[model samples]
Target: MEPPRRKASFLASMKAVFWSFFGVRKRRDYEDDAVNLNPVQVIVAALLGVAILIGVLLFLVKMAVSQ
Candidate 1:
């Protein structure tokens, strides 16, 4: 039988997704994340992170243009 899955906090899920965005995760960390995180959390965090990144870039461009 499979072991019970540990539910990681939202913050931890976000951190894992953030590191994944940069493609800089250690093997051990990845394995740990696999045990702690679920696909849905990762997908949601990724979408949120992408939205934030796009918003930041747009803000920067607007500021540069306004100067």
Candidate 2:
């Protein structure tokens, strides 16, 4: 009999999110993440990532317009 698998940690989920944002994940890594990552964590991470991206873009645009 096999032992039960451990749940992925929040930090692991964040690492997965970062790799996804860059759009360059390996197939093996993707497969591993798919099995380990929690849906709720992924959703939260994605929302946070999008918000950060928007904030950065806004900051850059504001700086460009000011100059």
Candidate 3:
């Protein structure tokens, strides 16, 4: 009979490769203290914050324009 497939190992290997990019990250155990934000998360949050600010500004402008 043919050998069983090894799809599980392929997924494990991909996870290892993906996490290797952030080598030796410091672990944060304290729940009451500052938490480290991942780079991508920080970038995304900044973008969303900027978008919200812009939306508020535009709303204010429209109100002023209509008055």
Candidate 4:
């Protein structure tokens, strides 16, 4: 029988993936360099940005269809 797997901590998992992808250690150097936003805030902003982008695209599409 296989043993139960150990759950990984959020920070540890994130750090491991960060280093593997970027080839460097994570730091707080950018923490105060600018306005810092949380994941939810970023996601919401991205969704809003995409919505605006899609609206513009659909407008262009409709214009082309009408022409």
What overall lDDT goes with each candidate model?
0.90, 0.88, 0.47, 0.51
Worst 10 residues of 1 by lDDT: 2-11
Per-residue lDDT for 4-26 in model 1, tens only?
67798778889998898899999
Instruction: Kindly list the per-residue Cα lDDT of model 4 for residues 1-67, writing each as its tens digit.
Output: 9754434344444444444345564366333212333444444555665686689999999999999
Which lDDT tens digits does candidate 2 get at residues 1-67?
8754649988888888888888989999999888888888988888888899999999999999999
lDDT of 3 by residue, 1-67 (tens): 9754333333333333334334532344222112333334444555665686689999999999999
- Per-candidate TM equals 0.86, 0.84, 0.47, 0.46
User: What C-alpha lDDT, on a 0 to 100 scale, does residue 1 get in candidate 1?
Assistant: 100
Candidate 1, position 30, lDDT:
95
Q: What global local distance difference test value does model 2 have? A: 0.88
Give all candidate RMSDs, comma-separated.
Answer: 1.5, 2.8, 13.9, 12.1
Best by lDDT: 1
Per model, how many backbone clashes are there? 0, 0, 0, 0
Best by TM-score: 1
Backbone steric clashes in candidate 2, count = 0
Residue pairs whose backbone atoms clash in candidate 3: none
Ranking by lDDT: 1, 2, 4, 3
> For model 2, what is the error of residue 3's alpha carbon versus the real structure, in angstroms, after optimal superposition?
13
